[model samples]
Target: MFETELTRTLNIRHPIFQAPMAGGPTTPDLVAAVSNAGGIGNLGAGYLTPEQLRGAIQKIRELTDQPFGVNLFVPEQPEVSEQTEEAVAQMTEYLNKYRDKLGIVQNPSIKKFSESFEEQVQVLLEEKIPVFSFTFGIPSLDVIHAMQQQGTVVIGTATTVEEANHLEAAGVNAIVAQGCEAGGHRGTFLKSVSESLIGTMALVPQIVDHVSVPVIASGGIMDGRGLVASLALGAAAVQMGTAFLACPESGAHETYKQKILASNEDSTEITLAYSGKAARGIRTAFMNDMQQYPGEIPAYPIQNALTRDIRQAAAKANDSQYMSLWAGQGVRLANDQSAAAIVKQTIDQAYTLVQNRFR
Candidate 1:
């Protein structure tokens, strides 16, 4: 019953998108399950290597023939100034305390910080994936055009109307209107994080008015209620992350899934501790301690690499305090059902709402 430009353009039965959550939660099984259920499932390939990305794409293809998307992080060359070096040193020393507690070695030798983004993009081109999406910043026009040439729908993430305008001018197929209530990293590339903190209700319609392309509303959206409200506000579709974190297909740690089911709306907070970028997650002891640190936090990928060992070790120990439990404010509504059930329930509820309430 719910069909819009996004559904028609993407060739999907529903206008729902499973937000491309990076790390472990967005597994190929999860992605394919959503597509099989009529929603577009997205693989968050930002941290994946070229070989790993190819393997994942193959895995997804094996599971379902439906269209799916792969999301990448636009690379940022953080200026390595003397101050940045100092901050890295300070943060490294501070994070050592957590290592000691987790019973892991301190100050492990670090060589590589991030995966090769260019090689990752090349895989997408060669594979001719159905859709390509990115966050943090826009890709070059050449890259965008290349994706279009291959008939792959390209989507960009935006936190403000101005960002949406910039993306439209750059010739994107669609723009995801990421709101302040979104979980994980903030995709505010145009303005300071504090300035781009617009809620979904306010951000979606303004972006829809500014840009001619379809706008996908993200952040804090959980159920059929959010889906109908976003459509009412001029959104062509809705993207959800936290809503799927607790799904059985999700690769999130067992402890993390439990936390999502047990937490509430007030349990999450945005912090720069886990990765230098500001992202929302359920508040933990690590985040609280980092808040009191007198030194500046290193830039993303740097800070992300520095704390990798700690997060991994905590996972092995089944300790939730140090893991990056990325989740949105809609934690109270998260379910522990299968991915197909979640998608079906959402569409059914949306249909009921439209039938009984709208008409």
Candidate 2:
């Protein structure tokens, strides 16, 4: 009922993709389950070291022979100089409050803020992943070309039409049009995050109009209804994260899953408190308290690294207040079913919808 060029090209049965929810949710089991169910499963490899990334790919391959994707964070090299030390110090002191609450050390030593993108890309190239996608910004032409040469279908994230255009020019096979309602980090590279906060309904078709590649609609899309709507909006497929977040196969913290089930549409807000970069998640004490901080938050991996210990401590203590519970506005639609069940239900419901309405 929902076959499209994407499904044909990717050799999948359904036009659905399990969004790559980095930071543990996209477990090998989860990715394999979705791929086995005939949708492309994506491994969020952004946080993994090269060894870990290679291991994960091998694990997913063992579980499913179907095509799957691996996603990476396009490295952001924020200036690290004397000029930024003051802001870093101010933010560190402010975050220390959470450390105290979590009963961790007052201050922690962080040797490195992020993994090596070059090394990670080398891993992907070595693996010859079926699909390679990235966010934050475009990778170098050499990297993209190398992946394509290896027969990997490449995809890029875009928040605006301009970003979509840029991705197409860079030779991505498809572009994920990420709207404001999306969870996790904002994939805004070409413009200010504020300037790029377009809704999915408004953003998808615009990007589809501007780009020659397939447009994959993301953000707030939760069910069969969203899938049908995206197809109507000229999207070749739908990439859903929140819908699969609480599934049994997902590796999201139990407390985070509880919040997803309990929270409603108004529960989430965009906050830089957790990750430095803007990302949508269910609000908590940390998010609210950080809003009053006078100092500018350190950019990206800096803030993400500084808060890592606190988040880990909070998780160990079974506290959701400090963990980064990334979920889109479709929080109300999330469930704790199995990954295969979610895929089947979505396809079944979409089929019924198409029969009843589109016919």
Candidate 3:
């Protein structure tokens, strides 16, 4: 077996982690399966309430006593101007069509935005979970210290070298070097998302050279080749999101799963139309329509809340045209398999590739 500080620290048989994919793709069963397969699994608790997060943690614990991680979305409060509201209003006609399909008479208003980070941290401390990961931004030093005091291994996600340095300075136990090719929301901290677009191959080695802590490479890593390349670049481990989306135990909707398997490398696009923040996903008609009326959309949670109902309806109808099919540029590399099978295959193959290189 390949040995590293990350593997020893996390007490895992392999240096692989199932990326915590938020917005329904990550399920407790999937997490447990990966953990049971001797890799670290993660729960994406970005959208869950404190109670819900606790419940999911309980379920994961019930399934396995192995070490796993929980990921949280660091809150960013973006100011909404009149122009943003007008931008969102432009989608009125498009959203109305979904109202009829979903049997809704009243237009849904924006729900209040809140991140239960403080409360959720308390839950983690109380539960004494092994690892706590954060995305979108890093938490304050005090918060990190608090979690560290409770023996939680803190990990921060970064889309750039500057963000990785910031995370190291803030005392993160390790850094997840999230590249531009990663799926879901970009976790840029220092610069605008546009300026921070570095691909995995270019970003991983640089962060590994610069950061003091262990670097966990994340992005378009899909198979054994990707894993071997990451290790060669000095990564202590690799975290994969899109690679696991096609797993049978994933919580992704049927339409989302089908679309993932059918997608080519060029099928995904980085668009803010769905959540008012940049995320990579398969191109859809709703995305195209939103582009025609771009400037009016509200920021993040507001825009995210505004379109919740339409997205729900679209999922129920198995309509890919309107759903947020988040994926990485390596969508074409995904395989349809059970989570346990995928984990075992990746670990075994990666080990073989690493051995061949040394020989």
Candidate 4:
């Protein structure tokens, strides 16, 4: 039988979840489209303000009545030292070039990190949102209990078996086994990003074996074969990021979508240049610049803030080289279709594979 709790809790027809991709790609239209297609779609609210988060949720509600999830980036207070300032200064040169192009004299100063987890949690609680997912780190015990008390289904992301175990201990209802081939940020928990880089084939089953909660396999899972492999490895469901990235409903810029369609398995790489945290994406000029200036990058939210203007300008100009272009190793599998069509096609193909195997 299909996994009962996951299906019942999420109210989804298929065991597929459209991963909550942060930065700019996961939009309300995308979330609504997937949910309408009988899969759980997610809003990546990590970078939005509390009001913006609420607005997006309301927008999704306007489109579909299906249950959906919101993903948050749990923030950690970093100790900013002189080294951090120097790193921020190092980005000035890059910022200056963008400023000149935009016809501004100086780069905009770093704005205070606007996302307040506490405030956003209150909003979710007030709205009685059905599902909540988190990456970057796990929420505190009190926060977890609070969300659970509101009857929200909680899912935590993990890049390794250790991270999976930790999420189980933290009382998450499910674990997203985010293999190295996944796009976006590497949710490595307390470990260094480099140390936890396990590929999908090797990581999913180990996490499934280690965690008491149900595992939702993510990363490099773009099609029927990938989905079947995840289920065989003990996953209750599968989450795909890059695969849905090319959908018309996704907020990914045209250039970003084109890059994914053009890429092969070897086109992406893990780099900390984008957000000061290691994430896999296509190699570009910005990535090259970061490589040339290793160890000079500021901490996240800081580096993320420093580059916001440049990234925005790049998106406006459709400049792939300067944009983040966040994606996974399964970029080649990204099909340019509507979100619902992609979901139906993937689920149908996977179901056929599963049935044929038994026959």
Cα-based lDDT at residue 352, candidate 3:
88
Write model 1 residue lDDT over 33-122, tens digit each, in one string.
999999999999999999999999999999999999999999875545676777777888888999999999988867778888889999
Off by over 4 Å in 4: 1-4, 79-83, 101-104
Q: What is the C-alpha lDDT of each candidate?
A: 0.94, 0.93, 0.87, 0.85
For each of the candidates, the C-alpha root-mean-square deviation to the true structure, in angstroms, is 0.9, 0.9, 1.9, 1.7
Give RMSD (Å) of candidate 3 vs. truth: 1.9
Give every collision pair in model 4: none
Candidate 3 overall lDDT versus native:
0.87
Question: Candidate 2 on 1-359: residue-level lDDT in tens?
Answer: 68888898899999999999899999999999999999999999999999999999999999999999999999876645797778777878888888988899977877788889999999999999999999999999999999999899999999999999999999999999998999899999988999999999999999988888899999999889999999999999999999998999999999999999999999999999987899999999889998998988888888898899999999999999988899899999998999999999998888899899876
Query: Compared with the true structure, what per-residue lDDT tens digits does model 4 show for residues 1-359?
Result: 34545877677888889999877688999999999998889998888888988999999999999999999988875645676777677776666766676555575776574467888888888888889999989889998898899889999999888888888999999999898999888888778888999988899889877877888989999988887888888888899999999889999899999999999989899887877778889999888876877456776777777778788888888889989988898898889999999888888888788788767
What lDDT would candidate 2 get against the real structure? Answer: 0.93
Q: Model 1, poorest ten-residue lDDT window?
A: 76-85
Best by lDDT: 1
Candidate 1 vs. true structure, TM-score: 0.98
List pairs with backbone clashes in candidate 2. Answer: none
Better model by TM-score: candidate 2 vs candidate 4: 2
